[model samples]
Target chain A: MSSIKPLVAVLCAGVLGLQGCASERSETALDQAAASFQAVKDDSNVLRSAPRDVIRAGESLARAERLSSYVGSGADVRHYAYLSQRYSEIAREHSNLVLNQERLAKLELERQRLQLALREAKLVSVQQQGKWLEAQIVSLATTQSDRGLVMTLGDVLFDTGQAELKNSASRTVLKLVQFLQLNPRRVVRIEGYTDSTGTPEDNLTLSRDRAQAVADMLVDLGVDEKRIQVEGYGDQYPIEANASERGRAQNRRVEIVFSDEKGHLGAPR
Target chain B: MALLALAGCATDPAPHEQMRLSEQALEQAKAVGATDEVAELKLAEDKLARARSNMASESYRDARLRAEQAELDARLAEARVLTLKSQEQLSLLQSRVNRLRKQLGEQQ
Candidate 1:
């Protein structure tokens, strides 16, 4: 009886040792896996920058661990069968992920190409279409150049201190809309500027309000909201300095920048 | 004689058993090549596996050394993973700083 008691104790101790070792090893393995995942999350900048291999390996390891959940027991036919199925499934999953990554990369490249083309076209149009405005509005740089629109706020638009579009200013706005509508493909950007006569804070506020008003007016005239973005620089960045009357007159102006596609970026609401 | 032979073969487990367990643990080394440390551990595990199986069938007393080597390799791999994780965290901090800078510039 005493011999049997010792044997039982030894067996129990052996089993416990095995369990401890397995658990410790598993703990270390899990910690490593977690660290790897954390690295991928931190490093991946874009949608597909994370390592695909880590994701695939982690999935397979999880599946394998699930299969061996009933460890130390006798061989389980069902467990083995499940494991085999899981292996095949993991293979398919890995391939699918690779395919998805490739597809996404191709799409991004295509988008970049289109964006480059759009930018080039904008540069050309900016150079060619708005040139006439410099001569017609105020002869700042080119009295007769074929590039870029130049709208003088002092001359044809609102009064020196007002944000309201004047009666004739309405005609100019209408003409601008007509130009956009006729082009039907140019996205317009409205930039508002002001003279240094007011406080910087006040100028900033006024410039923003003026830009918003112009944008709002465009929207009312059937321009898509998505295609338009408004930025107002009060007196910080003036094409012409604020030292002279003529320069201030030149400064108080609005410039329209169009998007590559003239239609609304989002649903026209 | 048969009983004695069976006892010799089946009695107390060999050090090779410990090595086998370690080898099995190595199977956790995922089959990935991601620059991540888990992959490095797995790769190291495969190398350690070569040493392990050799020790398993080895006639000498080197199995003990082989098992220890595998453990060391696993530890190294885990360390690599930790380093990668720390690097990743640093990169995230950099990104946050960039975002804050951009916001400040826009405000101005």
Candidate 2:
């Protein structure tokens, strides 16, 4: 009987050690869950954006605490604790998403407001430059042709054999943008022409690139891209003979053909 | 003794509903582009597989706990992916706004 008593005591000690280990694990999990809950519970943003999740965290933590007092309930306690921590994390993340979305909306509005201000400032500067420039653009550059109302951008706006429009071109491009904005229903086809100097293929590519560059600038200045059509004639439709430098310069030009106010465009050549 | 008897009688019902919920949560996370590369998604997937096995073996209590954990893990993964995407969008807009501001400054 004495031997049996010692053996039983040893068995009891082993069982108690296992229980203590399990409880220790459960205790750590419970502490972690409590910390997570404490961090998010008082956060106003989390409360506002994820109130239900925060409530669930609190409830799960409470359940875990309750289960920790029961014998052999360590698994249940840990499970609830893990769930509680996850809920806290989810709540925090949800709040962050909501705050970011709110900021995005505000930023988008600011961008629109800034865009409008910039447009107005540009128009003011163009007006300050002179009303006569507008008259010159209408009378000198624009003409009524069979294709439609055409406005020519002379070769001086670009360097020799280059597709990039010079900084000097901004004024003209801005004026074009303003015209399009004012006549919203009218679309424009920007046709590029080059002198008969380069290979026909190179001329074709350069002319297309120049037209695309102008179209890109118009888009950057807030013109709707759908209203712009680009075509490259590649020495096919020269305004003057390409034999002399002066004549070649005249031939290397971009012409803007405007659609009628009803948005009717001439067929592509 | 009575408490032990009550506990024995209170065998947990099979967590079919919880398993379904966890599966739905996992699908939702995946739908939002949460791949196995996401640690939370991997953890959720592992736990959910174990939970399925537990369910098949009629270990309802274990299955319920695992499914519950998996559901939250998947939800957290989804929330993390969404938050990350929003952060990316925020930076993109910030750069665009800065560019606009610079252009406006240049114009002025």
Candidate 3:
């Protein structure tokens, strides 16, 4: 039995030597696995963004190391080696995916911020435009009425008891034309009124002629002809008591009404 | 023992079909820009390379396994691309809602 024990020891040593040779034969796959593991561990992005995948890759690499130490270079060793490499690749991919997500979020945030700025700028522009329009209307001494805005020209606009416009009134017509040119979107209506100093038929005819003359003046000033309407109110709708000469003068006037931006002139009140 | 040997000797008749399917899946992933967009797609491409090499060496079992894995990875890449695109769409909708809210606040 003592002699047999020496024989068994020699056989055990021989088997161990064979195992060593097997491990040596598997060195290529084992080295590749080690390199992949090291590469993943060294990648700072992988460490920062893919902690879970890194841990999994490390686990697979440990398994591969254990498989490589086994008694034979076989399919199991190669399989574990492949798994280790694949897990390392997965870790890298996960890190890249995280980076992509961060970039997308940053870009989206920038877009939203830019959109907010654009909207704010548009709002400011609209408000400034509204203010400028309001200032222009005030400069024209126009009053807001049921039919948009109204500007009144007293009887001094015309020759006494005649439908013709006086030369002095040309300045007022020019100013009106400048205002209308600045706001081409607005439509205008001219209404002529007369005092109760003549026969009703004659007053009506004079009023109608005066309204048409004013409209023709606007058209001559480059305002669109279709944008102007003419009306006559003879001995009607007096704003002041016509018992005195001053009241009569106010009664015989021409009123120019401007429509809104949409050219909507509300029903005359 | 003889029956097991016979089973081992039997060849897989559909190896070519399996290889073609994996190649088609990889092509589809590439066509969708997955290789640059999704990092996992590179892994799938590597697996496909391995599968082709195994096929050339007549290692049918290894080739089949690698091919299937490659196909699975390619599909995973496709799914990831879809997920990222959906996230982008969600962000766009969120921005639109935010803009509308801002406009409403300004009107008030």
Candidate 4:
């Protein structure tokens, strides 16, 4: 086949040299070309379908038009037409693969964008709820020393020298739990601290007990068991100088810390 | 091959050509030893010798430091000689003033 092509090219060159470019090489093929494939040329299919077949068809048509000009110039010039057809087929195959890859890449990018958007939306919702709950923190630890939410105990939550929660304390804690439910993703650390006057060990024990009691209330309210961390500091870290009774009362309180992002505070039981 | 070629250029001077920069500094300082600067240079040189010996026994950091101190001493000896000449001129001027003061007192 390779040897035949050069021979045909030499013949055509010789013939064209004899006559001018306008002279017809043959009468039959000189008229016009009919569409090669009977398949309906669906334009939409070309744009929307795999680009391989359409591109191949296009290449075939171009080659045929070229060969139509050189019909009688050689015997079985159709071989060159076939080679050109192969080129179209190759183009079509590669183009289809590229299109499919592009489509898949776009879908994956869209999925990632949606996931990011969903995460941001959830974060916004949780932040809004935290801010709302912050408004509900009334009986907060009096002196604003550190950053975490400091809840004040309005005597309705506890009795003198008692680490147990009052019924009212339970009610307020339930409300807190509901607010926390809005952002259940974080773990809550419960700390109990007291005024500066008891046996160091006893105060430590009392603070611990009070913190645990609050944790218990939260647990019963369906908060995650693992998320509720309880610790007691006894009568140590006073918000104000423990020189006064008011300052001592101010120091006695419980604190809750939330440490997760998804608002799914529901640790396994 | 390259290292050998360069080694041929590496040569040490004769013993007398070996400059005792530290001792020379000491002598010039004695020539004008009234200046405290010369004493300070001698003290610094002594300290450097101590540092070098200590450094040679794997005390590399200390040895490098003592070598630096020795350089400072050599410079200090030269400064001391200059200071002594300046002081000598000042002393002669003071004596002239004292002699004039005695004349003034006797005539009065």
Best by TM-score: 2
Candidate 4 chain A: 10-residue stretch with minimal lDDT: A31-40
Model number with the top lDDT: 2
Report the error of model 4 at residue A13, Å: 99
TM-score of each model, paired residue for residue: 0.30, 0.60, 0.39, 0.33
C-alpha local distance difference test of each model: 0.52, 0.87, 0.72, 0.53
Q: What is the lDDT of candidate 3?
A: 0.72
- Rank candidates, TM-score, best first: 2, 3, 4, 1
- Share of true Cα-Cα contacts across chains kept by each model: 0.00, 0.58, 0.00, 0.00
List runs of model 1 lying over 4 Å from the truth.
A1-156, A260-269, B1-108
For each candidate, what's the DockQ?
0.03, 0.27, 0.03, 0.00
Index of the highest-DockQ prediction: 2
In candidate 4 chain B, where is summed lDDT lowest over 10 consecutive residues? B9-18
After superposing candidate 3 on the true structure, give the runs of residues whose Cα lies further than 4 Å from its correct spot.
A1-56, A71-79, A125-269, B1-28, B34-58, B64-108
* Per-residue lDDT of model 2, residues B25-44, tens digit only: 99999999999999999999
How do the residues A14-65 of candidate 1 rate in per-residue lDDT, one tens digit apiece?
7656543233344344445444444443543311432443454355445435
| Per-residue lDDT over A1-269 for candidate 4, one digit per residue giving the tens place of the 0 to 100 score | 56765665566566556553222332122222123222213434333543544454455545545544453422222332333333333333334444445545565565556556555665456566567665675344332334344455443467878878988786678767876677666566677888878788988998888888888888888887976777777776677788988887787887665444553332211
